[model samples]
Target: MSTARFLQIHTLHTYTAALLNRDDTGLAKRLTYGATSRIRISSQCLKRHWRKAEDPHALSTLAGYVDAYRSRELVTEKVIEPLRGRHPDDVVNALEPEFQKLVYGDKADKGKKSRQTLLLGESELTWLAAEADRLAAEAPDAKAAAKAAAQWVKGKNVSVLAQNTALPAGVTGALFGRMVTSDPGANIEAPVHVAHAFTVHAEEAEGDYFTAVDDLKKDEDDSGADTIQETELTCGLFYGYVVIDLPGLIKNCGGDADLAGRIVHHLLYLIAEVSPGAKRGSTAPYGRADLLLVEAGARQPRSLAGAFRRACRPDVEEALRVLDGHLAHLDATYETGEARRYLSLAQTPLSSPEGSGLERLSLKALAEWAAAQVGTGADA
Candidate 1:
């Protein structure tokens, strides 16, 4: 019987599952290690889990990999043993090949069964049984043991393990006691959440901005001279917040307030171009203003609600006109083929209670109405 060398490996499955179940704000808080900037999951997670399925082989392989590392004696003898007196870098480099072989072995022309059953029968069985035994041993009583043994193993703690990995400089800012970084250039922080995405869905039409503007102007005045004289502008308003990992920002910027401000501006500009709207205070109101933030909590509720209420002030008709003009300007400037194509697609008219109109909309009212529209559209 071949004796398997032990290794200690940590898995992030449980942490990821917890993150996935959490609300965006909660997730942002937990993941942002103290940076002012928000961190999001990399494209890697999206690709991996988007279509992943449970496979017995994969599960068994993971179990074996974990068992090999869980043994303190084996780990000491195999891994830490070699590093006792050696430099860390040299030790890591030397151990890499051996670790790889243990994790993933080459099996040329081997039968599936033989490859699947790499460890001896007794060893494999021991590996599988140890997980249950460990839980049982750790429990305070028999009842607790039984319950714990039945609970599925979700592997080691990830946040703790990730702490062992060092973050790059200028990537440690605090958001509610958690660390986050806003240094756009720093890439050490693991992307564990996605705050926003730029796809075909948020774009607008090429001529839609101009058309909307022209229509709004024409509606205001039927006089042909006034219509022709109105400035033909194109623009859109894209609103969203880039969660700055406050700690990370401080770390990168060395606590430079000016640099942090620049970073915020740059990120806002980037997100704005993706959506159809001129930035806030830059142009007239578009059809609707989207508030995009890494977490919903990032919004200053009183201030935001006040702004929306002010937009609707004077009268609903005036507000709509303002919104139209703003949206038109945004579309004209940032209307890429991607955004234009998305706008060209047919959309259902918003379904509302009979006689619902802008006149009835306060900031809070508008938000509620918009929420209903989204819910109905999604259901449809």
Candidate 2:
């Protein structure tokens, strides 16, 4: 209902971490943001950490974070194997026509496995198997079932039909999205865009030499460092930004507007609380964003990360002052009247705009407010 296609989200965090995310060589990832050098973490690394995390607040099968696993074995492992002996004839035959087109599109191959396996979630897989089961039970024979499946595949947009019918197992598809490389038609674009996290100030990467002894060599007479390696590290306040496109999310999910909103709610909490697992054993760089700000509106989304281009002194008062000035400048230049809400959580002091209509909120309250933003837009 928001009429707008996107809900941009951005954050500024200061961390006291030591080598939070590192490269293959064990050096911290680095980037030049706005102009100055800064510690950095790749978007891919951040996403992998989120998907693999098991925290109560993070997405987990036990916690009911709706998701699917993409694999060729979905036809066998998820469906056929689970219902083996229960169905006569090859079970894969019963589902190929129905699932292949939806997942593979023009590159669909009935007898062969997908060139690139789709990471289909359990929810979608289960739904597909259930539909196949119904057909297997209804059809007089395997040949008949395959025939019926072919007819089922002839619907308008089989990809949309298969997914739209089943509420996605979780929010993964809606938030992170998917792309079927072999079949562009099966691609589901991700609504959220995360920028590489960078330090707020200019800093040079430092190398630390360290030694690791193998437990097996611990009692050996010649025992020395089994492995000697140098690792790089950097510590400082960092700025990270994420933009969520609301309407684009709905489109990817086949018009499930409510689901798009729910995914945002979960992501709001997940992004702030989660840390990338770059080098936990050697450098457990762990810290949460001390300052978080959420701004919602119909205005064109923009990142204020450039605010750190010059590298300001590390002080809470000064940081907030700079942010306030940037916000003022953006407001004056852009017809930002499209902005409807501002929710902020700050550990340090922040001077409020005299009458700018900004709401300072706790993190939980902010997430709740953001969760409810779906249906309400400029018209609502």
Candidate 3:
């Protein structure tokens, strides 16, 4: 059977008044939701947190999935150190443009050494580094070497690497993908859709007023505070959603369903467990999801955010009723029969269609069900 077109994961989490993500002026991030104001966490913040939360074992299990390198400096560091040992000083210096242009591409500005940072997968990186070594062996002149190098990588397509169906899957590349501004052929569309998390109920941000006293100047004349500042914070339940394109995943992994399954398992855990780390020292807003909904099906994806269009209080009973209503409306409007949903929450479980046959599964059981539907989520 064909896997679902998309994997949608949603959560509702309650956090205290400590700040999570900060804005440009060092205030807590906020956005308008449900016709009211609500605290917001950007998709970038969530993705970054997920990337950092990965353990060595988790990465290793994803089939040697090295994080994509978008920095020319970092790429240079990886490419140059190895060459320094074998090549002459002049040759090493000359090879920079060859490797840079080959891996990256022609620069936008005429005189720049390397183009803008582009996403290069593990396989692409390894291949480029090997090609650099080959260029050194083939010629001695920098211009000739660069010409040959350009010819080598410029013709390669990102989709080909994306559709690679081999082992040691390029995890980050296969999912997040890479884009080269100068080369359209090297652009790989990201298969994962990330949504900015926003509060279901809108609440105005409150400022925490405080002052720090100076330790040394404790005299009666110097009785004033050394520092006085205000920091913004919000307290509310937030809703976050992420959807994965199943066919896109298969294409990205080159039809490696087993690898995709492992990645999905790890990704779900990451999304559920990781919290945005902003103002960690003073305003550490650490919270966990009170309700998690993980679903897989061939039906077109939808969000339950509409349930809070009028905004409701943080009452469990009220929230449940609203969620059920929105979901029912969605099904009625779409008549999406090929959908499967699973829910776990703190309140009384809604009967039958209230959850739309969403079986309440344990974390382990949820992963198992997803694996059974697609492929084995076995450890690499």
* Best candidate (score: lDDT): 3
TM-score of each: 0.21, 0.75, 0.83
How well is each residue in 1-380 modelled by candidate 3, as lDDT tens digits?
A: 33466677878877787788888898878888656887888887887677666553254456645556556564476665677777665566666764555545555223345457656666666655665677777867666665665576565644444343342225665777666675676666677888898888877578899999988885887788999998887777888888887767766766677767777777766766667866677767676666667766677788878888788887656776777678777777877653454555666664455334568776666666655554521111
Q: Per-residue CA lDDT of candidate 1, range 1-380, in tens? A: 11111100000110111122113333321122222122233322332322121332221222112111212133223432443343343333333332222222233113233222211122322333343334434656545543453343223211222232222121211111222121122123421122321111112212212222344464644634332222222222211222334333333343443443333333322232222222224333223223221111111211111122222322323333443354345335644111100110112211222221213223333223222221111211
User: How far does residue 43 in candidate 3 sit from its true spot (Å)?
Assistant: 1.7
Q: What is the C-alpha lDDT of each candidate?
A: 0.26, 0.64, 0.67
Best by TM-score: 3
Q: Which 10 consecutive residues of model 2 have the lowest summed lDDT?
A: 161-170
RMSD of 3: 4.1
Over the stretch 206-319, how does candidate 2's per-residue lDDT look in tens digits? 677889888776575776888998766666766778887776666655566666566667677777777775567766666665666666667678888767787887655566
Give the Å shift of residue 295 in candidate 1. 15
Candidate RMSDs in order: 25.3, 4.7, 4.1
TM-score order of candidates, top first = 3, 2, 1
TM-score-superior candidate, 1 or 2: 2
- Cα TM-score of candidate 3: 0.83
As for lDDT, the candidate ahead, 1 or 2, is 2
